[model samples]
Target: MGWFGDDSDEAEAYKQVMQRPQELSRWSNQLLGDAAAYEAGKAYEDHVAANGHPDEHHQAKEILAGVIGDFVDREVEVQGLDFIDRDWAKRHAQRRAEIELYDQHGDRW
Candidate 1:
């Protein structure tokens, strides 16, 4: 078994992490519609362009905190794994941010 438990549990955890972006995107799209979503996405890109890409961990936490709320302690529990910590949050956020950036600018830059 892996650290989390059986392989199935690990897979479930991976699935949960992987689905975060879609969840966020759906939420944003429903709440703001396409035009606003595009604007929101551009904002993230602008932040990266102006301030440079955030440290992966910080970026994840920032996204999570923005989407949800401030993280208590250093971690937040999620599916499969014992908890979703800042590092995991960061990795997820980084992927989400990249997709958002791509959606906004495509291959233009």
Candidate 2:
């Protein structure tokens, strides 16, 4: 009979050392980024309403999230983490974006 587990499972478990500090940092960054985006977006809209729309496009949430995402990647490397689940981080960012949008506008769209 084959063994009940494989090397991949054990290696993954060992690699994840529960980075509490980094997790806290990420949470703070996400919250701040969302708040900043919401405020900046409102200012942008107000400006556009008064001065007409500009030719350039402005997406505060996406831009802020992308900047934070880059920082997360760099942090993982600096923290010497064996494995960082970028996909997981990305999912959190998407969820936060949706929530912030709804909270700011009272609409899920």
Candidate 3:
């Protein structure tokens, strides 16, 4: 069984993809254990939004990956570039509010 469109591999592929329900359920339960964790905090989001520019995290990741520089050395390496000209915080908050409402109303979010 291999990944070369072999019929013999179909069962393996099926099992691989379908085998994660238990793990997914366990992970979901663990994640949802604290209801507040899913509650995205505004101050935290704002902080990330503010400090996420010029992506120090990305730079660190690239540095770890052995890209030698204080930053990623490429034109395509722009970070924290948001195309939307509006305050994403409000939009994000609204989406979260909807999800929270769904969760509160006994519907899965």
Candidate 4:
């Protein structure tokens, strides 16, 4: 029994959710961090500093927006979402990995 359905039922609904590759909020944060790091280069920093303190934040915002936009634009590249069932995806992934390991190397020898 699980979110998708009981043990007797297939987890098709759950699998659909798992197959999607949409980036989460954390991905945006990571993109922002990376953008900020790159924009922190001396030349960029100097240019912003010349403008004013507020301009620095503005520049960082623009850079982060662009980075996030790029990532969103490429969201379609995510695949394998509908292969199984979303609710069961995590358990399926774990079980598959375990089975793979067992197949590669017997559990007791």
Candidate with more favorable, higher TM-score: 2 or 3: 2
- Best-matching candidate per TM-score: 2
lDDT of 2: 0.42
How high is the CA lDDT of each candidate model? 0.37, 0.42, 0.28, 0.32
TM-score of each: 0.29, 0.39, 0.20, 0.24
For residues 9-94, write the lDDT of model 1, one tens digit per residue: 22344334335544432322112222222233445555666887556645633643453222211113332223334444444444
lDDT of 2 at 40: 34
List, residue by residue over 1-109, the lDDT tens digit for candidate 3. 1111223222333233234333332322112211111222222234445775224444322222222121112201232213222223234333443343334332321
lDDT of 4 at 64: 34
Q: Tens-digit lDDT track for model 2 on 1-106?
A: 1111223322222223223355533434333333333333444346546875444333434543565465456645666543556546545544554454445544
Give model 1's clash tally. 1
Q: Which residue pairs does candidate 3 place in steric collision?
A: none
lDDT of 4 at 28: 30
On a 0 to 100 scale, what is the lDDT of residue 107 in model 2?
Answer: 38
**17-72: candidate 4 lDDT, tens digit per residue:** 23442644223322322222232222233543586433343444443344334332
Q: Against the hidden true structure, what lDDT does model 1 obtain?
A: 0.37
Q: In model 3, which regions exceed 4 Å deviation?
A: 1-86, 106-109
Model 2 lDDT, residue 49, Cα: 64
When sorted by lDDT, best at the front, the candidate numbers are 2, 1, 4, 3
